[model samples]
Target: MTCFPFLFGKKVSSDVRRDPEIDEGLSGIRIKVYTYKQLKIASDNFSPANKIGEGGFGSVFKGVLKDGKVAAIKVLSTESKQGVKEFLTEINVISEIQHENLVILYGCCVEGDHRILVYNYLENNSLAQTLLAGGHSNLYFDWQTRCRICIGVARGLAFLHEEVQPHIVHRDIKASNILLDKDLTPKISDFGLAKLIPSYMSHVSTRVAGTIGYLAPEYAIRGQLTRKADIYSFGVLLVEIVSGRTNTNTRLPMGDQYILERTWELYERKELVQLVDISLNGGFNAEEACKYLKIALLCTQDTPKHRPTMSSVVKMLTAEMDVNESKITKPGLISDVMDLKIREPKKKIGLETFPSSYNASSSSDSQGTTISLAASSAATTSTFTLKHDQSM
Candidate 1:
């Protein structure tokens, strides 16, 4: 294993191949790859002392670089489903994307079969940790700060969806994926399951990949993916942020009530304020809270088209809106609500599995066609004015 200094260092072997196309998108800086042994020493030979956290993919270790810069290194398990392609995709996507509310990918290490991603160390771990701790000392976050986080995340997503040359959809957006720095500024992380959507296409057919509770209904049930799917996930995240609770955590009361159903019930009863985190202690802006809740409800609606675009969501969050006079649209009855009593057969579709005969991939030059407008309309009780168009 070769070791290199971080500051005023001599360049090591040039075995690393540089792809000009990929390098052009980067910040005109080449990341120095660290040998496995160097990382082993920095992480104290992957000792428990340096272990920060663990997730489905792998364990994260806190390490100090030779320059004394602290970083969080995610060491992927050999058996993890996310392989080289997915890992490289995450690095390419996150590195090109620069935003205050999005986590920064410092570099990556790919030594033989070993894969690791290094990111700037965030003092505060994740929103899930804080929300799950039941208002503990380090978990304290004012309602104002939470609201700002929501706005920041919305901006980041909007940039990904609208600004990127080929729009990208973060297939897995959740509380655990949102990291916070020492200043409590929220940054969206995790892009292992993201998909790049070409500008000409309306939707992309892909495997249903995401946490169950956070997945959009259409994507989960029908294998249809779109930017609105991200909106739905963001909606779930919004409720979690406002209420300071996990969607799937049954420990909280109300008969294992999912966040969507609980929020709807509270909305109907005009007790939406009750759903807010008690930690707020009435210090949050009531009008802003209601507005965000309404936007979230719209996003979580069963129908994907009914959900607002990322740009629209950003406007609703930041622009001056007369909440007192605004009329919110109610969410449609979700299919899961009906399926709670009856189980349905799973339908597999997309590149990962056999493609569904119902639709074909749309080409850039072709005019998109509508495949199953009636089926789409009937699937959700929520109605949208937009027409369903597909092309291949």
Candidate 2:
């Protein structure tokens, strides 16, 4: 293995080819191959000042290509458990797909052991940083803008699930993965955990991976991944977008700590509109906002079969099709499944009637077990990359 240097202003050879491992991993993928030196210079030697985001896989830095196009460069950490396979997976998945709502892959750098992916930079960052981060960002998310964002994300997921030759399941669909451009148009980023399902396959049985708050009950417990898993996560994100809050906020009262649980309580009381972000301040259409919440409930039904398909969700959102409120049922709440030890309600919501059937101590397989970052407040626990087992 050839060793590469990360020092600033240090001279490096520009003639090196892609690593053999990377070449084999990205055999069929057609994308620009960026040299380590080029990226080093593009990012000002990966200066801390230029760093835009950090996650379990690696850190993302703002860079400018030779063509003068601004880019978000994701540098894979050498210490990360996500190795070359994930690096190639991200490229293979995104390079083959294109949609206005999906992040555009500019290229990648795979010289020696330095693995990096370059993407088009979005000015506003992700929904987690701006909307859910709570006043950390100056960007404002009005009701109309939030509605457009939700619809755009639905269309993108619809494209991934239906229009692609081999349907793609976005394993991780949290707020942090949803990026925003200057127009506030939502673009789904981060494809490292994406899985391609052949037309005939019902589901892919794999190790569970995803944020605790956004993970589907079936996928998290049984490890059987399908498009429905993405739908469940999307359902959680929909609520987050509507309410302008994180899925699980420990700061709130125990009963309202989980967004899905709280949404259900409000739904039963015939006041779903109350779940909308108060920041909207009477500007949003109450009926429309409530409709979106109902659609979210439909997507998050306890039974995966009950969840509407992404295409159906798009129609529901656009008012082309009605959201069948009759079909909405209690959602599979992660907090309940994980037993976050909520203070029992004075009048326990209908939730207690349904016993925890899926509560297993741990995964049976030696594969990674789920980690609930929502349960912890450690400074190192980044909501962005808290999906996989940290011990891995």
The best candidate by lDDT is: 2
* Tens-place lDDT digits, model 1, residues 1-392: 11112222333232544334333322233465666777887788888888877644567888987778788888866675444556666765675467788888777766666777788888887676565445643767887788888988998899888887578898767776777888888888877677888789998876556554666767655567899889998998898888876664434464434667788888888888888877778888887787788788988887778788888888788864433324345554342321111123353212221111000111110111111111122263432222111111
Q: Write the per-residue lDDT of candidate 2 for residues 175-291, one digit (tens) a residue.
A: 777889889998998777788888799988776566567777766556678999999999999999899977766556778767899999999999898899998888899999999
- Taken over the whole model, the C-alpha lDDT of each candidate is 0.64, 0.74
Pairs in steric clash, model 1: 361-392, 362-391, 362-392, 369-390
**Model 2 misplacement above 4 A:** 1-15, 337-392
Q: How displaced is residue 153 in candidate 2, in Å? A: 0.4
RMSD of each predicted structure:
11.0, 11.1
Give stretches of model 1 more than 4 Å off.
Answer: 1-31, 252-256, 321-392
